[model samples]
Target chain A: MTVPPGRRERKKAATRQKIAGTALRLFLERGYDAVGIREVAAEADVAVTTLFSHFASKEALVFEQDEDFEQRLTQAVTGRAPHEPLIPALRREIQALVRHCTADSAAPIWRMIDESPALRKYEESMRLRHAETLATAIAADPELSQTATASRTIARFVIDAYSLAREAADPEAAVDEIFRMIEAAWEVTCPSRRA
Target chain B: MTVPPGRRERKKAATRQKIAGTALRLFLERGYDAVGIREVAAEADVAVTTLFSHFASKEALVFEQDEDFEQRLTQAVTGRAPHEPLIPALRREIQALVRHCTADSAAPIWRMIDESPALRKYEESMRLRHAETLATAIAADPELSQTATASRTIARFVIDAYSLAREAADPEAAVDEIFRMIEAAWEVTCPSRRA
Candidate 1:
């Protein structure tokens, strides 16, 4: 049902991945602030312009998945099955996200982000934008739109829970705990309906 | 039942206020990062060493009320009356804090904070500390502590709502709106409980 990328698309994707991977390695090795963009381009065997074409900023390299993550969260709510409540829809979306971000291969990257203030601030901005994006989607529905405060509150709570979960020692346990908390939040805001 | 400061204590408080006021003015005029601490000290008619003694860093000067704000949130939870619920107690605390921060006299200071990334980051750090402090207080109680996720979720929800409220054109309305959201949260999390 899906069409794969053609040669040009595949080549661009490969270049982007290579640049990002090389930048991450260099950043992790020499520290984010210390590593220059020229160094990354040189190490990646690409021009500085090519690196800029791939990523807008150094922080963008570390957070390469940000846009995809935001899209998936918005789509999860907007694309929920009929009769499915918002909380469970979000839980499904968040579970997948947490799994992806917490995979075995990503541990070092997560640790790197934890140690860097620049990355943390960048991550925080992304987190706020995620909440805003979700909020807009939630507000599009007439039923949820009427309760603006509650809608934004719920959106923020879910995102914050997900971010907090990332810090847990056991990602699965953290995800489960957050899911339960979401259910509890749903119970208060929408008492007549169940998640 | 409260005691006022002695003459020496009062003079120290006055001096600290003068330095903070001068620093804020200079930061606002020349930008946060551009303004030097020595300039602030000179403007306030105090030695640079004296200014350093009062505030550990420039960021600290910009966020002078942060410690007081955190203490008040913790005390609100800890000092709730026997029958008072957590939500209203937090509401009362947040309302007072919001009023203090959003006063007409504090508009320029808030605007300065809004314009400066360093100030925003410092404020975000303070906000996280507030959540941690509130979570610890929430955990001290037997009922809510059982569910760690819910306790933290609620704490974060309260803090986030308050921060969002500050951006409102009419802060009073925003405060009221946030309080209602808090009540909805309490209803969901603590169903039969009154707090």
Candidate 2:
């Protein structure tokens, strides 16, 4: 059901990956701020203009994967059955994403983000933006549309819960624990429906 | 039951206030990073050492009120009646704090925080720290002790709910709405207790 990229698209994707990898390496070796865009482009054997075309900014380069994650979240929420509630859909989708993050390939990128203050800030801001977007989706539901502020808070809570789960030593155990805690939280906040 | 400050203690408090006010004014006019400790002392008519005695660093000066807020949260949580449930106690305590923050005098300080990236980051980091401390308090309760991660997530949820309420046009109304949202969230997460 998915279309494969043509030759030009494949080459463009390869160039972007190369540039980002090189930039991350330079950032790790020296420091994020110390590494110049020009240097990263040179090291990656790409033109500065080409690098800029691929990524709007250095921060964008580092956080390129975040877009995909956000998209998945949007799809998970919007594509759910009309009767499905927002919170459960979010929990299931984010848990899958969190599980993927625990894979071997994600370690380096996670470390890169952990070590850089700029990246950390970027990540935090992106998270807030994502929550806002998700809240809009939640509010689109007729039942939830009336509680706009509450919807925003719910979106934020789900994101924060996932973040906490990810920080745990055993993420899978943590996910189960977080869901239980969320249920407890729900009991006090709303008693009408069992989430 | 509280002891009043002696003459010397009152004078020390006054001096600290003068320095902090002057520092805030300067930071607001110029920028957080642009304003130096020496400049703040000069403006406040205090020596550099005197300012240092009151505040260890520039960031500390900006976040003095935040420390007080955190202390109050700790005291409220720890000082609750032995029979009180953790979630209800926190909800009551933080709602009081949210009311205090809604005062007209507090608007400028909130704006200062909103305007500065450094201050925003400092605020976020403090929120996380407060959540961690509150989580400890929540975990100390026997019923919740077994789920440390859940306690943390609950703590974060409370703090974030408070933040969302504060941003609304009517903070008190928002607080009420947020509590309802929390109940809804609790319903989904844990339906047994109607906290």
The TM-score leader among the candidates is 1
Model 2 misplacement above 4 A: A1-18, A28-42, A45-61, A115-118, A181-195, B1-19, B29-60, B181-195
lDDT of 1 by residue, B56-112 (tens): 778889887787888888899888887667887898788888788889898888888
For model 2, the local distance difference test gives 0.76
Please give the range of 10 consecutive residues that has the lowest summed lDDT in model 1 chain A: A186-195
**Superposition TM-score, candidate 2 onto the true structure:** 0.77
Residue A57 miss distance in model 2 (angstroms): 7.0
Q: What share of the true interface contacts does each candidate keep?
A: 0.23, 0.52
lDDT of 1 at A6: 86
Give all TM-scores, in the order shown: 0.80, 0.77
**Model 1 stretches with alpha carbons more than 4 Å out:** A1-16, A30-38, A45-57, A173-195, B1-19, B30-58, B142-144, B184-195
